[model samples]
Target: MEKRLLDYLQKILNARVYDVAIESRLDPATKLSQRLGNQIWLKREDTQPVHSFKLRGAYNKMVRLSPDELARGVVCASAGNHAQGVALSARRLGCQAVIVMPVTTPTLKSDAVRSLGGQVILHGDSYSDAYAHALELEKKHGYIFVHPFDDPDVIAGQGTVGMEILRQHQHPLHAVFVAIGGGGLISGVAAYIKAVRPEIKVIGVQMTDSRAMLNSVTAGELISLPDVGLFSDGTAVKKVGQETYRLTRELVDDFVTVDTDAVCAAIKDAFEDTRSILEPAGAMGIAGLKQYIAQHNLRGESLVAITCGANMNFDRLRFVAERAEAGEEREALLAVTIPEERGSFRRLCETIGPRNVTEFNYRISHERTAHVLVGISINNRGEVPEIRRSLATQGFSALDLVDDELAKEHLRYMVGGRSQLNANEQLYRFEFPERPGALMRFLSGMHPDWNISLFHYRNQGADYGRILVGIQVPPADLATFRTFIDSLDYRYVDETQNPVYHLFLC
Candidate 1:
């Protein structure tokens, strides 16, 4: 083990990466440090030339190739960060580069490689397909195949990140958190950190849905995942490389698995501290760091997390924003059932008093009762049980849906549609100030005889909130309802006779 580490250390020291990659800044996460009660540092690999640490390894391998190999060119298969890394490296080294990517690869990424002068080939439907095609081309055209994370040269190049981290901070670090996909980054980092600072724990983080390294280590052999989640697509590896898995298993001190929600929250956290949006996989290290500190109840310790990449799809930010609150335990989603009688809904609102309602969806599902899909902001996860207990005190039954993917992703939007039970329902859209008591005041001001048959609201992080509501009233009460709405002085639009409402909800 000593001799093997020595060999890697020598190679890392001699690795050539400065031609295309920079030694990125190690920035302090002040907000995270205060919140977690620990000093948190982020190694900003996302600031590299290709916006990822991949260039370090890609250039290290390509720069070492013989004249004949460089003349023949290099081919690689990548769908994300590594593709750009090789493209940038090959451009800097004055060599022809061919990057094979899945047909489903985003145009943003393929265009990025083309901008760097790499020939782009759109191949099969997945990375594995592109990889096989790249190998075929390599053999046929005498092109050197650049492995993303498997080769010794690549591993040594990535090790320089660890070297930079150690050189940047000489403080007492409790652990160094690294996100793992094929295990290459963590393997190289662990090799260096363990060799120099043996007492500092080298921890690996993986998305729960794509944890090939963790599963492989547990089984004492390589394991292939049948399918991996694509939310953190950068780290969604089916099988870790043989060399990477070996080094990771031997050198890594611990492992943590984080879910999509947690990763989203970490991205939000990173943004709060650094004002930079991190990709899901890039934020996994910070997510795992928080989990570890909380699980062990540790405080005042120093820790480091590598922000690995920033090649995020802009569209994914919407999904990440929606889940970030729940991921950080700042919001609780619940399915609350209440008696369908008049004033029961108001009482339920009173039960959730003083807390900001992040979301609410309801429809008159039955004659005697109603089910509400609600999201309430909370200080911590511990507040969920308290909220549930409060609902029970008011004769309401609440089902915790904070972790229910269906309720969060689909059921919330599908909560109310064409309810036969609400025959007399009149739909209206209302707008009011977005504040703790604003919603309560609206409920309190409604006439007691009027029955609320349906409702939909979502917090848009704006100064005011827009709500869609359905109220059931006798024909005689239409004039009074309009008068009451006018008295409230809130912005509202009458949608009772709208054709779309007639088609979808009436």
Candidate 2:
């Protein structure tokens, strides 16, 4: 089977299905290579026209269709790279292509499909749903279904990535890190690499929340997941392809699952090293490399990490930016409650000292209670211990929110919607202690009639923190609110007219 697949790949290569040329002299970065103590050569798959390795397989499969099949056209389901590949390939081959994509797929992706002359059908809400709908269209219209990663032809075509990796690197390669979803890319790469250079290790990486391939391999059979978390949406497969799983089980060296946090950290690292913004899936290979180094205690070994693709949602960058430091263990979040009395808030601020307060969120509800949430930055993961010790000595109650999903996702969004209509509503920016109960003191100090209208706080780990607070004030009560704010002895900025707050917060 392996021999037949190899011959088939060679035939596709000889047919000149791809227009892009592969680079052979790519070099390893001095900083990254030295840090990992390995000669690490990146495959640079992102350099392709579609900025992914998908084109190789899509073209290889499409170009080999018989005249009858080509006449009937072809159909596929993809949200990003695969969709682009099939669209371009279909246009070049003079065949009609119909692509089914999830409704949640971005407009940019759908537009790209149309731009390449492919008829795109938006259906369902996920890749799996789109795929099922595509199957129905394939049967009804008699269009040839182009399998994204499961077919033999597709696997053979993707094997070209492994072939290029071997030809491009100079030093002896000890290991290769590949990201896994349905296992098409890794299966192809592993089959070829193990067949030719069996000594070289082929490790696979998957996001912990979407480890279909990893779980299947461990279970000794294909096991489908009911649902998968989609932080790395491109690689969020619930089931591994049957053939891909068979090849992976036999040829792949090992598998590792990295959490969302690790993937975020790897994205930052890849950007810093290559000035490239890798999507979470693209960064999986590098995250696996870090994990492999730590797990096996292997240092100074030659390795290669495939930087797969860069088709990332622009809005998702904000989430990545917010979590990168904490994912890397360079920042920590805490919820602290302090006494709701005069000078208590000031004393809490004194305890924070020069340490930067990245975020400060406060809400006052009850007559005598306030809840304050704060995030702080540290030099490294190791510094967390010292920071905790200091907070303990300062008599502040702290609850870490670094790994709290609820706090990160929902609680932060719902923090400041509480407001009672009052004649003395005012919006003030206050720098408060990050400790707990600090918010209660702020609320306690306010008059009973005052109501909070808007609140927004994001932790950036900075010293002398700032928080936006909205309080309801009647037209005649402005002086009273101003006097109350002035007595608190904190700087205040009025942003009731800020366009951003009005549009997003109000």
Candidate 3:
């Protein structure tokens, strides 16, 4: 082990990566430090030319190729950052580059490779399929295959990140957090860190659903997962590289498995400090770091997390934002039951006073009681039980839905439909400037004589709050109800006559 570590140390010292990669900044996260009571530093590998640390390994491996091999060019299979790295490296070396990506890969990623002068081939629906096709091409066309994580040269190139970190921060560091996928980055980082500063712990971070490395280490052998989750697609590897598995097991001090929600929260944390978004796998290190600090109850010690990549799909930001609060225990989802009486709904609202409601979905389900799916903004996890107790005191039964996957993804939106108690009900859509008390104020201002039959509201991170509401009003009072709505000055559209409403909600 000592000999192997020294060999990698020398290789990293001599690695040629400056041709395409940058020495990314190691910026301090001041806000996080203040909140967590730990001095946190981010190794900004996302600042690489391809917005990923993959370039360091790709360029390091390619620069040493023999003249004839360089002439033959190279090929690689990657669904994300690694593809961009090899493409950009081949461009700098004036070599032909062919990138094989799964057909399911987003066009944004494929187009990025093309923009870097790499030929793209969209193959089957998954990385395994694309990888098989790339191997076939390598044998058929005599192209050098640039393995993403397995090769010695590639690992050495990635180790340069560790070398740079040590040189940049000679101060006392308690631990270094690294995100692990097929394990190249962490293996390389662990190798260098352990060799040079053995006392400083090297920690590996992996998503709970795709923890091949962690499982392999635990089993004392390589293990292949039957499947992996796609939330952190970059790190969703079924099997880790053999070389990487060995190095990680020997050099890494510990491993932490984080869930998708925690990764989403970590992404939000990075954005807060740097005003930049991170891909799920890229933010895994930060998630692990926070977990470590909490579990160990450590404070005031310096720690580092590698911000590895930032090639995020724009559409995923909404899902991340929706789950981030839950990950940090800052939001609570509940199913509350209240008596189906005239004043019970109002009482429930009064009990929940002051706290912002992130979401609310309700329909008159039974003649005796009504069930509500509501989301409330919270300060921490401890607030959940307190809120439940408060609801109980008001004669409402509350079920915590914060960790319920079905409740969060599907049931929340499926809470309303046609009801037998909807007699004389009229539907309306209203848009008002969004603020903390918007929903509560609307409910309080409603006429006491009117009964609410259906209600749906979700915070979309938009400037305006849009809600769909159904109110039961007597036919004789239709004119007065219209006048009342007009007086509120909120933008409103009557959905009572909409064909879709009749089909789905009436």
Candidate 4:
């Protein structure tokens, strides 16, 4: 293992990527360091010319090709970053590059690649599809193929990040966190770090819903995920690379998975420290780092996290901002019901105390009870339970909304009165696949007797479609309704017992 890692480390030390890939700075995350009680160093790969660390691997691999192969051009498939890196490298090397990208790849990224002089071909829905299309093109045109992360040269090139980190910081390090997609970055970094600075841990980070590498590592074999989340679209790979996986199993020290809300909070944290907005995949390292520290109760350790890219879609920032507070436990959302009598509102506010109210929505459900959806600022995660206990002691029925997906995503936006006429309505939150005819399929799959009473949907710049649905089912058809739900393919959660539903639409 040492000999193999040393071989990769030597390749990394000699990787020819500096022609297009600059040495990104290891900047101090002052605010995060102070808050976490650790020295948090951010490897600013977001400052690369193409705004990603991918350039190092892409350029190194392409530059290694013979002049004859270069003249024939190069082809590759990528989610976004590697496409941009290849495009920029091609432009620098005076070679033609054909980049096949998934249709779901953001226009913000595709446009960046095109601006770098690469001929862009929009392919299937995901990177795997694009890779297949690239393979066909590679055969037809006899072009040199540039694999994004599966190739040895790419992994070795990415190892340059570890080399630079050790050079920048001489202090005893705790860990270096790298976000994994197909595992190229971590494979390379782990090899180099373990070979030279074996004391420092090499941690891999992944989005919880799309963790091909983490799942594969756990299973001790490569496994494909049926579907992957697209919120952090850059790392939404469904399969891990074989070579990358082998390297990871032997070299990586730990792996952590974080959710969308946590990644959003990490993006906000990055901005607070450096005034730079990173894409969801880029902020994953910091998110996982925060989670690891909390789980392990570690403090005063020196750590580094690679902020890998900044090609964030502008439209996605609104959604990130909405969930960031909840992820950081900076805000607590609640559904509180109060009697419709006079002075009830004032009494509710008094019960809430002087805490800053972040959001408030109120609507009368009936002549007796009114539901109020409110968001309150809190100092930490502990404050949530304290606030809930306080409300309980004051005879107010409060439902914590921090972990309620239905309430946070859709219910808070809609505050209409209960259906006085409809009978036996059941509420559900569904994650519809982001494809054509999804809504039609959902409608067709339902039984005619189950009428959809209430519905709300808004695209959160993610792969899946989220909708809050209320259906009227007669008491006799309860069994049939449950059977129909079990047959449907989409992921769903029953929200009928949710206090927010009772308050707003029961």
Candidate 5:
């Protein structure tokens, strides 16, 4: 079956598929190769017109359709790469294409599909929901449903990537790391590679939060997940495809799952190495490669990592940029509670040495205590343990939230909550110097009865830093609160009428 598929792929490659330029000869960086102790090669699938290997499979599937089926058109469900591929391929084949996508999918992807001449139907809240809707449409309209990574023809189409890699390389390939979602790409590549070179290792990578293929392979049966973390939306599959899982179980040599942080770090690495911004799924192969090399201590072996796609949302880049530093162990975040006293804030700053402070967020909710969240740069991964130990010694209970999902996803965004809300709340925007003792001076003059309701501060490169402070005062104490603000000797704006603070903080 594998040989037959390979033969069919060879014919398809020669007859139907475009001779996409092979980019295999590009040499790996000396620094990276030396660090990994392997001859690393990147398969630049992102260099393709559709910015992914999905086009190969889509084109192959469309070309083989009968005249009647072509008249009926082709339909599939996808959020990103597959949508673009199917749209472009159907247009090239002179057939109508319909793409069904989740409503949560970004507009950038939907626009690309439409631009490629595919009729896009936005429905449902998740990929599974969109897929079910697409199946219904297929049954109603008699349109061919092109499975993303499940069908045998699709697998054969993706197998062409492996064939190209082998043909492009002069040296023997020891291992190839490929990202797995529904597992079609890995299944095809593994089948072809194992057939031609049984000794070559085929490793599959999936995000730890969406590890359907890894879970299925481990259990020796197909397993479904109730929900998948969608950081890498391209590979967020609740269940591996039936055909792809079968092929993977028989052909894949090893499997690994990477956390979202690791995938983000790999994205930064790929950008630095190749000057290309790969989507989270595209970077998974590289993340898996790093883990594999570390686990087996495999040095001086030739390894290839397939950069699968680059269809990333521009808005997501902000989140990626924020987490990339901590993901790479170049930054650390600490949540610490300290006494709400004059000199205590300064003492906390004294504990942090020359390491540049990336972020500082503090709230004076309690009369006697203040909670401050601080982000600091780290030299390397080894510094984390030492930093934790130092904070412990300083009588500060510190929570290391460098890789904590709750902290990264929710806590950071909604840190200030209703816990601090009280009657007569006044929000003030104050600008202060960036030097030490600034916070101490601000807190020293505060009235003992008045309480801080909310506090938010993020350092932007500015001459004077701005902070939002919410203070609660009794109705009778309005005059006293005004006097307190006047005594602080800082310009303040009353945000009591701001709708955002009233709705969220109140």
Candidate 6:
């Protein structure tokens, strides 16, 4: 190991955090192990007092502070997990703490931080926004800024988790899967593990849409994401820290990205194996582990995943449940067009055979053929193509809607609402910001000249708020409407000409 790397390894070895954090257990996922044909171990950091590994870094860094810095107190910004860590650390250290969080943060997380004796300030819409607000507070109040994952001390503190994992498990570790946000946890873990067990791989996991670190490492330079998905809010960092980026690129063996559905499925996997629920960010490692295992087709080797946090919002479970089956490729959603003539329904069922039907929705159309949405249970993703081919063989056209975000988020719910009364009504799909009053801001942004005929939205705990809107614009105002949309500055798609809209929602 290089001199600087060895120095960090020593810091991780000597970090003091037991005053608050505990040595989380290395529990084996026996059921998952049997299913995957490999030993899968979970580093139970969710069992931390704050229900996250963040406390380790928070307390470790705070304890090392000088008397003057301790007296000055601390402030930091986080989506949720690190806020709780800072809060709990401050409560223990007998110093005041101020946690700045995005207004889009989950209520459960914000409440937890408040209960831990930290003053919670609900600030901007994004972590970058909150960080900016936090910096101002730091300067104004003479508070020490507590970086969530940037500082060497924080990274070293998190490295203790690697130490515990190695000491607890004598079995050869093929890889240690970790979720990366600002890269502190993985950086610390990777540094220690590489110094001590160089042969073992340190893999980093990230949500596909929120993978700033992944993109940066791939580019071989730090990259800033203009926006990030919020399903895994704790790990939705726009940019990784400088030191963390350097360490991660050097120490991490590979990077893997999983989508929202995969994380949802991983959450279900954890619950099934250990009867414990993990948040989306916590489940990221498991999702990446499953993806990696399938990609390499490896078996009989031991692998470890950090089941890092469990501060899940109760309401989010419904969305997680809905997507888990699809994520695991146990379910496939299809849109089928069938003739309105007699025996069409029976023939469709016959074609579907005895496959478990999870969802079936049908609406009569004015056309000769009708569109119906159906979800079928399957053994794996490969079955989707087979089913599509089977439907084609039966003279029915089937469109696989499993990977279609627009279909899953909106079309599935609004397929029955076909309209023809409003002339020149334009259909649009929008990605609104997730912060409070976002809808109001969108509504307010529109000109009164363009009347909103219809609007539908459901929060999925994601960074971008998905909303579908229908507005009436006179043909004469088409150019004005185009200009208005451009001024809105939100990601949007004109769905006015979409066949699905024509079939059911025009």
Top candidate on TM-score is: 6
CA lDDT scores, all candidates in order: 0.85, 0.74, 0.86, 0.89, 0.77, 0.90
- Residues 1-506, candidate 2, lDDT per residue (tens digit)? 47755664464345343553244235475567877677667777767677677777888888889989999999998866788889888888899999998765656667877998999998865578778999999999999999888987888777878877876764578899999987878988887777667889999999887888888889999989865655676776778788998889888988888987888888887787788788788889988988898789887788888888887666667767877787778777766666666665676667777888887776555455445667777776666666667767867666666775545543456554543443344556666533456567778997777677666565433212346677787777788888888777554566666432322234
Model 3 bad stretches (over 4 Å): 418-506
lDDT of 1 by residue, 1-506 (tens): 49999899888889998888899999999999998899999999989977889998999999999989899999998867889999998888899999998765656678899999999998864566778899999999989999989999999899999999999999898999999987778888888988888999999999998889999999999998876665676787888899999999899999999998999999999999999888888999999999999998989999999999887767668778988988999999888889989999899899999999988888775788778878898999999999999999999998887875545654578666776688678777876655467788888988888899987886543234658888998888889888988877666778777544552366
2 against 5, candidate with superior TM-score: 5
Clashing pairs in 4: none
TM-score between candidate 2 and the true structure:
0.77
Model 2 global lDDT (CA atoms, 0 to 1):
0.74
Q: What does candidate 5's lDDT look like per residue over 172-240, in tens digits?
A: 878899999888789778877877777889999988878988898889899998767667778878888
Alpha-carbon RMSD of each model? 13.0, 12.0, 12.5, 2.6, 11.7, 1.7
* lDDT tens per residue, model 3, 1-506: 47889999999999999989889999999999999999999999988888889998989999999889999989998877889999999988999999998765655678899999999998864566778899999999999999889899999999999999999999999999999988899888888999899999999999998899999999999998876666776786888899999999988999888998899899999999999999888899999999999889999899999999988878678878988988898999988889989999899899999999988888775789888878999989899999999999999998887876546644567666767678999988877645556677778877888999887776543334558788999999899999888877666778788544553365
Q: Each model's TM-score, in the order given?
A: 0.82, 0.77, 0.82, 0.92, 0.78, 0.96
Candidate 2: residue 311 lDDT (0-100): 72
- For model 4, the stretches where C-alpha displacement exceeds 4 angstroms are 424-428, 431-451, 461-464, 471-499
Q: Which parts of model 2 have CA positions greater than 4 angstroms off?
A: 1-17, 20-27, 34-37, 341-353, 363-371, 412-506
lDDT tens readout by residue for model 4, 1-506: 56777789889999998998888999999999999999999999999999999999999999998899999999999989999999999998899999999877877999999999999998877788899999999999999999999999999999899999999998899999999999899998888889888999999999988989988989999999987777888898999899999999888989999998899999999999999999999999999899999989999999999999999988788889999998898999998878889998888899999999998999666788777898999988888888888887767788888888878898788877567775788888988656678799888988887888888889876656888888999999899898887777677889989866776777
The lDDT, on a scale of 0 to 1, for candidate 6 is 0.90
| Two-way lDDT contest, 1 vs 3, winner | 3
